[model samples]
Target: MSAPMTPDAALARLRQYGERTSTWSTATYNDGTEKALHGIALTLAAELEQYRALELGTAEGRVSAKCERAEHPVWLRDLDDVRGCPWCELDRVRAELAALPTPPEPQIPTCISCGATGGPLRPTGDRYPSGAQQFVCSTSCTGVTS
Candidate 1:
């Protein structure tokens, strides 16, 4: 486990962001946020799996008497152990999503002649004047938008 961000570092990062005027985009901060969450997601997944397995083993009583494991603890205990409340924090959630299993590639209308397939189609925020997935015409063939 890594140490939590120190107050000084966080304040410095925020101060850096304040210096910028045009757009408040901080690629480094964004990257840090994503990295932190990815670890959290993995940690949560592992914790969840461990809890489930322990539960199943106890239920089945397959765990040997000699092995001797403890009963399932309370939610608060588990949460405390796993550093819970990630759901309440935007940064944690973002990190978790960053590490989440990605959905399968979307089915797209491919250009038959050129055999060009579109990349993962996520929201680009701004609505284009034409309101279409931009495509290009090439020597192989003409392309169209989704």
Candidate 2:
């Protein structure tokens, strides 16, 4: 499929900078830049879906072509959708796990200092640093015990 944005189209648009900007102190280029930032974020989101689909080896030529034409949240949604999806087979393990019973909870370790109850245990899935165990604050989220 075609790229998300054509470099030539971007360069062509950039050639009109002063002409577009000269219309006002902040023209389409200025306001467009802020809007472009948000636009690009959405574009990247869509691309991520396509990339994932492509990686899973399930994305069809038609689907990949459609992804090339897609924009914003709609493409994002389609990419995330699993309806008649080529990669639905990837869900088997996850679906089985979700159907299983919950395991016994791990014991919460209390904080010796301040006699604080252990607030939380950081899971491996947490966005914490590698090998870092984040203890939830005894008082509040911002409260970190030294």
Candidate 3:
């Protein structure tokens, strides 16, 4: 008679089957094989969950057996073994990013003729009434203001 499959072996099998099924195409897919794999995976997962529940001895001790962010199994002994939830980690990163100081905007030279700001500014080669050098927009400017 064949030996029973261990939880570790079942997990490994599930991972192997998962990888294989992910790359399967319609042309090469087998319904029987897929169904069998699903049934086996579901049974193994349930058994594993039950095993963990029994081992932990409490509902509160029933933490996730896998890391959602990494999509990998986490052999946790207790709640302390949990690093953090994926959403919590993401929110923490967002908060840190939000806390960072935003850089100041660059000063744009103003056009003295049209009072326009931004875009290219060029010297009008003329002086304002206050003897200050005047600048104008490179396009559609009416020259220096009086």
* lDDT values, one for every candidate: 0.46, 0.45, 0.64
lDDT, ranked from best to worst: 3, 1, 2
Clash count for candidate 1 is 1
Off by over 4 Å in 3: 1-6, 25-28, 60-146
- Model 2: which residue pairs collide? none
**The candidate that achieves the highest lDDT relative to the unseen native structure:** 3
Structural RMSD, model 2: 13.6
The C-alpha local distance difference test score for the whole of candidate 3 amounts to 0.64
Assess every candidate by TM-score: 0.23, 0.23, 0.29
lDDT of 2 at 133: 36
Error of 3 at 96 (Å): 68
lDDT of 3 at 41: 76
Instruction: At residue 104, give the lDDT of candidate 1.
Output: 41
Can you write out model 3's per-residue Cα lDDT over 97-120, one digit (the tens) per residue?
Answer: 989886443244568657666557
Ranking by TM-score: 3, 2, 1
